[model samples]
Structure formats: C-alpha cells, structure tokens
Target: MTTTLPRVIGPWMAAAVVVGTVIGSGVFKKAQKVAEFCPESGVALSVWVFCGLLALLGGLTIAEVASRLPKAGGNYAFLRDAYGHWAGFLWGWVDFGIIRTSSIAVLAVMFIESLNNVLLLARLQYPADMEWIGTGLGRWEQVLATLSVIAALTFVNIRGTLIGGGLQMVLTALKVLSLLAILSLPVLILAFSPTSEPQPSASNFAPVWPSDWSQVNWAKFASAYGSAIVAVMWAYHGWLNITPIAEEVKQPQRNIPLALIGGIALLIFLYVGANVAYYTTISRNEMLDLKGTPVSTEFCRRLLGSVGVLVGSLILMTSVLGSLNGNILVAPRLLYAMGDDGLAPAKLRQLHPRFQTPSAAMMVFSGWAMLLVVAVAVAKETSWIDEKKNVFDVLTDYCIVGVAMFETMGVAAIFVLRTRQRELTPLLPYRCPGYPIVPAVYVLILVAVVANMFIGTEQRTEAKVGVGYALVGGLVYALFLRRKEA
Candidate 1:
C-alpha cells in the first residue's frame, strides 16, 4: 500500500505552480469589465495595480502560515492549526464541496469554451454549437474537450506530485514565453507595419482620477469598483494555490514562502504590463466596446492584424490549460488531507500502490468536476438556468463571496497563531515582513471587498448562493463530520 507523498518539487517548479495556477483566462478576458469599472483609463489601470498589491499582501500573509505548517491541505492545515478543528473542518467542507472543485470545473469550462474562438477564427466548424442527443453528450465538442482534459490531467496527477509539478513547469514556461512573444511581436509589428494612425495618446492617462468624477454619482463608483474587483480578484485568485501542495514541495520550509511571494510579485508585473500594453494601444472606449469575445484577441488584432486572433487564442488556451493542470494536481491533496484527519471519507487517503500518488483523491475530484461541466452544459441546453449565465458564471456566483471570505479568514489566522505560539511545534521559520500590520491591513481590505460583493451591486443576488453553500457546509459539519469526530 502506498503510505506517503514525496517531496520532490524544487523552488523553480513550485513557483511555476503558483504562476501557472494564477494566470488563467481572467487576465485575457477581464479587461472589458475592468475598464467598465474604472470610468477612465487611469482608474482602470489602478484597479489592476491595486488588486495586484492586495494579492501580494495575501501571498505574504499566507506564506508565513504555510511555511510554518507545510502540509497537503494548505488552507485546511493552517485553519485547523490557528482557529481550531471546527473552523478547519468547515473550511475543508466548503472548499472540497464547492470552492476548489467548482474552481477546477470553471477553469476547464473556460478552456474548452475559449477554444471555440480559435476554431471559429480558422473558419473551422465544430459540434459545440449543435445538440448531440437531448443535448446528448452536452454540446458534444466542448463536453468532449473538457472531459478529455479533465481525465488526462487526473491520470497525470495520479502519477505523483513530481510528474504533475513537472507538467506544470513546462506548461507555465510555455505560457510565459508565449505571453512575452505576444507582447513583443505586437510592438515589433507596429514598428515595421505601415500605419498612419498614431499610437494611443499619453493624454488617455490624463484624469487618472477621471475628470468627470463630480458629474457621476460617487455611490455608484463603489458599485462599479465592486463589480470590477470581482473580476480583477478572479484574475489574482490562484496565487495561493501553491500552498495546498506545500508538503510535496522540496524544502517546504523555504520554498513554499518563496513560491507564494515570488509568484504574486511576478503576476503583479505581468498584469500591470498587460494592462499597460492594452491601454497604450487601445482606448478605454474601444476596450469597453469591443465586439470580439476576448479583449485580448481584438487588442492583438489591432497590432498584429488577423494573426492576432490566433495569437490571442493560443495565449488563452495555454494560460487556461496550465491553470487547469495545476488545479487538478493540487486540489486532490485537500481531500487526502481531510481523509487522513478522519474528517473526510477515509478512502480518499489511499495512494496508488505503484504510482504512490493520491490516486483515489484525484479520481474523486475529477469525476465531480466532470459532472459539474456536464450539468452546466445540460442546464444551458435546456434553459434551466439563466440564459446569460454559463457554468463558469454560475459557479463564480456560487463561490465568489466564499472565496473572498475565506481568504480573509485565512489571513486572520496569522494573528490567531501569534497568540497561540506555544501551540506551534518547532515554530515558523519565517514571518511576514511587517508582521501584524501586513495581515491586519490585508484582512481589513478583504472585509470591505467581501461586503461589496453582497451590498453593492446586482451581484448581491449571486453572493446569496455562496452564503447558502456556507450554511449547508456548516450543517453538514454539525451533523456528520462532528458526529464522526465524536
């Protein structure tokens, strides 16, 4: 019987996991909403920078905790250690049942759905738009694509963290290289391509605060910022995912913190550069008014012509695929941890005798994610859910509040542990630079952001779903998990 997971992933590979998981479809797809939120080019760019900072702070706060308690279930272990078994159990309950699994499902959906744009650009047709059987196979091409990636990744991870981590490093390297190519090729083409039109004026950056603020309802700005941050925060969402697999990271004592911080720092630079690249070429109006689905494709086309579509699509595909693989690789460890603690089904703790990986955990996770993909497709086909909402949007709604809420909870644990230092074993080898203030400010911002998710916009309705999921998790914890513990 397989009794353990190996700690074989080095710092570079671990940082790749953080970068790979965090840099998904959001950056490629979310600029329109960000522009819509900011009311001006500067404001929009500020949102990106601000969200990046917030994410960086979160990385710092979580890093200290992660290094101190390097384990399979990243948040699960930290929460239990700082808060108590009940807090940890509740987080694990919701994370496994909704947060992490739905996140994986959403990434898979984004990957397959985005592929449609690439296929269309090639003048190729797919069965994605057609019905297979009573919506059979549920939008055949996409469902097949989603299932194929999910299955292949599940098997890949079942091979062990090293193989999975290695796969992530390759995918992330390709993604980063591709992104650099996309950024550079455009400027080079603009330099040589004959164009009478001038590049975007520096004046666009004027009114960084938006000159018309007095003309607008200040209250509405909160709502707009709230909405935009939701998307922006989504772009920054995967930064801490590296921590969940900390136990498998070589030198978790040192590497986990480095990966978490280094990854976010890298993302901040990438995100700011991407935004600067887009706005320097495309106007806020043009970006907000884009007819094309992905703002990246259109932005690319402006610079690279028709070839931009292919570039944009490939970039998105690589980004989402890398993120999808990272998700599949790390998310199962949460279940394995829970199972080892006797809080989850014990079977999940079993590793493959030969592969020596969390085979059962990966299979269980991917199987549920496949169901979510199919259910979303079927719901779309039958019009059972909102016509405007797809699986990704619905899942986002179901968990966005919980996502922010939990991040805050995790950060607050830093203080919780400070008081309980005696509770720590060997004690943390590292600590956040500013200590209390770093985590303090981070939690304050999270509270404000989470409040906005509920009180500020039409999005409030969706946040209710997240609340319901939490309540249900609480009930399950009380009824079943608690009883088992007793």
Candidate 2:
C-alpha cells in the first residue's frame, strides 16, 4: 500500500472542481435572499458583480499562497505554515466539526429537496409515515435520503479522486449547459415567438433602481447590502476548495493558479448571467414575494410549466451532487493532513491500500455530516428552534461567520508568509498580480462582512455561536490534542 496520494487530477478537472462546487444550490436558492435584501434589480446585480469580483481577488491571492505551500490540507496547511500548529489545528477542527461537514449536510438535504420536487412533479410520493424506529425525526424519508447521498458520494470518493474529478467534469458541463439554457431560453422565446403567452418582457427589467432611492437611509442600506453580500459570498464559497487537493493535481504550480483565476472568471459570468435571466423572466417584485419556491424553479415553471420544473429540479440535483462530490473529494484531504500533522487521530492519515484515497478520513467526514442531518431533523421535530428553518439554512447560518473568519485569515496569511518566504520550502511560481493591494482589499471587504454579520440582528446570534464553536476547539486542543506535540 502506497502512503502517498497520486497526482491524478489535471488542469481541466481542477477547474471543474472550482466551478462545479461553487455553483451548487446557491444561485437557485440564495438569489431570492439577495433580491429581497437589495430589492432593486440594479442593486442586486451590483451585489452579485461585487461579490464575484471579491471572490476573484481571493482566488488570485490564494493562488500564490497555494503555490508556496502546496499541500493536501489547502487553507489548513497555509494557516499552519504561516502561523503555528494551533492555528492550523483550529481550522481543521472548526472545518471538520462545523464548516465542511455542515456544508455536506446542507448540500445533501438540498439534493433531496430537489429530488422531492421531481417526485412531486411526477405525481409520485413516498410513504407519508416512513418512520425511523419511532424517533420522530422531522421527516424520516428526506432525512434517510440525505444520508444515502452523503454515504454514496463518500464511497465514490473513497474509490479514487480521479473518478470523483471525472464525475465533477461531466456534471459541471451539464450544469453549465443547463444554466446557459436558463439564461438564453427566455430571450429566444421572446425573439423567435413574440406572440407567445407569458413570454419574458422588457418591462421586467424596469425599476432598475428602487423607487424609494431618494428616501433611502444610508445606514439601513449598508446593513442590507452587507447581508446580501454574505448571501452572495455563500454562492461564491467553494472557489478555494480546489486548493485542498493540491497534492493530487498533476502540476500544482501551474494547474492550481489556472484553476483559481480561470474558474472564478467563468463563475462570475455564469452567476451574473443566470441571475439576469431569472430577474428578466420573473420580475424583481415577484422574486421578493416568493417564499417557498426557489426563484429558479419559479422561472422554469413560468417558462415551460410542469416540464420546466422537472428539468430545473434535475439540473439542480445534478449540480448539487457534483458540488457534494467535490466537497467530499477535497475536505477529507484536510483531515488526512491534520492526522499527518498529529492534530487529529493518526488513523485518518492512512490511505486506501488499493485506491490511495483517504478512506478513513472520508468515512469520518461523511458520517459526521449525516449526523448533522439527523441533528437538524431532531431539532425541528422537538421544537428546538424558534424559526422554521431547513437543514440548509440552519447549517449555513451556523457556520457562515466561521467560514468568513477563516477565509479572511487564509488570505491574510499571504502577508505573513511573504516575510518568512526563505523558511518556507517551496518557492512560489505564481505571485498575486497586485500583491499587497489585491490581498489587502479582499481581506478588508471580508472583515467588513464579518463585522456586519456580528452587528446585524438576524446574523448576530449565529455569528456568536460560530465564533464560540471555534473557541471551544481552542479549548479541546489545549487540553487534549496539544499533548501530542509534547
């Protein structure tokens, strides 16, 4: 059995991991929240564009960082090499226990929700009372379905990263084509068949600015814009995920940068284009009014009725599954790196004898994610929460502040590592274009976002909770894991 993971992922697959993982479930769902916060089409579009640009800056900055410390753990490696052992341990700790696992659970639940849509469209329903040992979970069928997907994807990734990467490429292609269809179909229908009923109209683009712009309160607007930016950032969250598997990429120096910059450029285009298509198809006011149905589902339903829903749901399910696969493929490598560093159980570092993948790490990550899914279900059923949030909302809110903090720190690591470049082993082949300015700007914006999250009423509780979770990791490390270093 080889102890090393093979460098099997090429440039294209690496890029697919970036684009595919970031696009999942966000544009379809979070756009509504963005629209609600921004209201005006122009404001919402600016938020999308602004967030995309920040993400691109982040990508460009991280490219140099990844090249300098090319390793399996991505940001964990960066934080460790740049700061110290405990910094890295905290990232791995929060990531495994909160961020990444919660992400997997959220995506799995979303996939199941899309599946439910398909079934409902087909007039098929699962047994209403699919009890799970009489535990009274929120919805047993959905919960079980979520676990099945997380498990299945874990198995696929356990087979090999190449297989997972290949699957990501195919799903990425399908999702891109699906998004293109969503972006183009409305215009095509209106252009070639102007007499069609319920066709997309030019008027949907009106009121580009809010009617109350003259009376707007700058303070309230800033808060709302900050909220919208966080949501949009979620849509852009996975851009750096590809870096986690740097050890498995064919040429880390070349491929990782290409993946980072090129992938983010494409994502910005696709995201903005898809949102424009949605707003034009369904007016801004209508989008704000939408409650249960996602904006994408509504756009498709309007465009092609029942058939469109099926198509949209299938596209979403595939997109989400692709993201899930990418997450599973990359996240375990972080745990493996942590184990290799003695921050986690040593067993997590073991690779599969035949597959050369982090089998133990994959199982642990997926199992925890499944547990989170169960936790959400039980919480809801037992009235543990005041609001009627789904697994996705609850988990995303729980982890967003932590994600923002780490991501900011990861980018900021650039400055610290630069001064200590001689001590770091690998010489960087790629340098960030704007150096101090690029990373500086990205860090500042994220700092503002994190601050806003703490200030805003809705996100304040979650932000505190997320920070508290990370602080607890510090306690765990000081008491137990820190002994390993001794």
Candidate 3:
C-alpha cells in the first residue's frame, strides 16, 4: 500500500508559503533592472503594476483549477489530466531538472551571499581571501554556505508536512516584516527628517514616460519592455508553487483559492510599495548602474548609514531563505506525483513510513540542485559564457521560455477541463472569476512574452534553450515510458 501525506497545512500557513516564496531576493535584485529597462519612473511603475495584475489574473484562474483538483502535482496534475499524461510528464521533468532546481540553487546562493553582507558589516574578515566561483567575492565560501543551508532545510522538511509548514510560517512572517521595513523606513525618514544626509527629492519621479517612447522604433520598445517584464516576472514567479502542495493543505477547496489569491494580492502591494521605497532613495540611472551593490543595500545605506547596510543584508538573507524553503518543499512533491503515476523512478514515489513525506524524492531533487550549483559555479569562469550574465541569470532565463509556455498551458487547462471533461464539472467547487476572458488575457500575455523572446537578442538565449529543453524532455519521456513498457 502507498503511504499518503497528511493534511496538515492550514489556510494561514498555505498563504504564508505563497507570500514567502514569491517575494524573494528578486524584488531587491530586479527592482533596478526594471528601472534600467523602463527608466521613466511612471512607465517603470506601470510595468510593475501591470505585471501584478497579470499575476493576479493567472492566480485567480489557477486557484479555481487547483480547488477543483487538489492534488500533489498541482501543475503536472492539471496538465496531465487536461491535455495528456505526456504533457504533464514533460512539465514535471523540466521543473525538476531545470526551472525549480535551478531556482533553489540561485536562492540559496543569494541567501549565503546576503549572509556574507551581514558578516562584512560586522568588520569580519571571514572569507577575505577565498575566491573560486568569482574574483575577490568568496564565491567558494558562498557555494559551501548555500549547500549547507539547503541540506539543513531538506532534513527539517524530511520530518513531515507539519514541520515544513511550521518552518514556512516563521520564515514568511520574518520576510514580510522585513519587506515592510524596506517600504516604511524610507517614507518614515523622508517624513520626519529631511535635513539629514541623503533624502529623496520630489524630482526622482520626473520623466514619467520612457525618454525614447516618442520615437517610432518598435524594436527598441519591445526589447526594453520584454526585458523589464522578465525581471518583474521573476518576482512574481513562485505564487503558483502553493498549488503543488495542495494535497497536504487542510480544507483544500477553500484554503487553496484563498492562499493563491490573497498571497498574490499581498505580493502586488509589497512589490509596488518596495519599488516606491527604492526610487525614494536612488534615481533611475543610479539604480541602473548599481553593479555589485544590492539595490536594497544601497537603499538602506542611504537611510541608516552602517546600520541600514546590515539591515538590508539581513532582509535579503531572510527573503532568499524563505524562497529556498518554498522551492525545496514544492519540487519533491511534483516528483512524488510523477512517480506515483509510473512516469518517474519508482523510488521517488515512496513516502517515509513514519513521516509520510516524500523523503526519497526530496533527496533526489536536492542532489540535482547541488549539481546545478556546481555547474553554475563552473560556468561563471568559462570563457564562452556571457560576461554580463551570472549563473543565476543564465539559469533563470533558460527556464523563462519553459515557465511562460507551461504557465499558459496550466491556465488554459481551466478552459480545457471546463469544456472537455464533463465529470470534472462537478469537481470545480470554485469557478474562475471572469470565466474565459480572464484566463484568456493571462494566456495571451504569456504568448506575447514567448513571441517577445524571439524578437529580443538577449531573450533569444533563454528561448532557444527552453525550446531545446522541452524537445529533449519529450524525447526522454518517450524513451523512458517505452523502456518501462518493454
């Protein structure tokens, strides 16, 4: 008999998972990129808001589907059931091997890197001479720290869903409070004391539209807008992760939808408000040129001097840790789902006897992520690699095309199941708001992002990689399934 995971996560923890996972280091890292692409505070902020709306639309639609079919494989389950088993299998493979596992490595790297920032503020000479992945930055130390954290979290989660839920709650709470601090401190300093060192001027919000928008060059605008959207999309990426653990959620019908929508709504508020705080401290061009210095660090440096720098680093560490935990928790469940269906190695389907957790799958997933970390570290020094892009950026972009494409399928599954599967009609306890139009818009935007990928040179790297990844996944699945049958 197959062991089953217990329904231990409540509405609040589920929602916290949603919030914590989405608001990672990207908000701090990519806020500047958005400014680089859009430049004009008005257009830049508009892009952020527009992306939030798109995320919400996608969330609401996904919430409906998740509620209808609350299962472990969330996206994989939806795709398999709606399209075909093969469709879901490939998504699982891509997510496990590339998108999600790389995200874990990246978030862990960011976490350790931020922790290093904290140490530096304390006048610590720790890792002063270590440099393996990059020059003079203790890249080797960062890699070790990242792997240790991932290993620790994996063990904590190995206990069961209940323990993981508890850890998620605490991390999410700390992350949200830190973000609020980022938002509030700037406005507070501006409100109370203006005569102080560096305060935001009313002039920072000027030139509300892109300086080049008046020109009729569609190519430039598309490139700029697409790049900005990719950055924003990075921030909005993990809201869907909540659905993957839906089977472990108590009252999955109500909690799933509430967590999905509420978490994203909260994200919208935090993302936009955080940028307002960022712009309050740094001008658009300054934001663009902030190489090596984290945007949050620069913001905090301007606010509380030395103390703010430590605070900024701590905040980033907290955020990345939360995101890392969420990714680790979600990906194994996907493997468990696939394995349960005979689509993956049978060992992945085995749940721990006492814990009822997908312990084997978690280890497998972590092992893969560890390999990616080493691979990225190696790629950082390789001559053929793009000098401008780091391992995180390259890995993230490689999956961008796959993520956007799969997201469209997941959303469109709402439309697919609602019409094609008569039996599932009764299962949809929560109907998507706005019916066809809302999801249609979500899918259309994703379609545009995929199309935009082809048009932009920088984006083409990820696009070509994504296409090749999908094709390879399909080819591998066919062979694997054939071997199983044989």
144, model 1: CA deviation in Å? 2.2
Worst 10 residues of 3 by lDDT: 128-137
Superposition error at 355 for model 1 (Å): 1.4
By TM-score, is 1 or 3 better?
Answer: 3
- Per-residue alpha-carbon lDDT of model 2 for 94-143, expressed as tens digits? 89988899889899988888887776666532335333223222379889
| Model 3 quality (TM-score) | 0.94
Ranking under lDDT, best-scoring first? 2, 3, 1
How much RMSD separates candidate 1 from the native structure?
Answer: 3.7
Let me know the TM-score candidate 2 reaches against the reference structure: 0.94
Per-candidate TM-score against the hidden true structure: 0.92, 0.94, 0.94
> In angstroms, how far off is 175's CA in candidate 1?
1.5
**Each model's C-alpha lDDT?**
0.79, 0.86, 0.83
The candidate scoring highest on lDDT is: 2
Cα lDDT for residue 349, model 3? Answer: 87
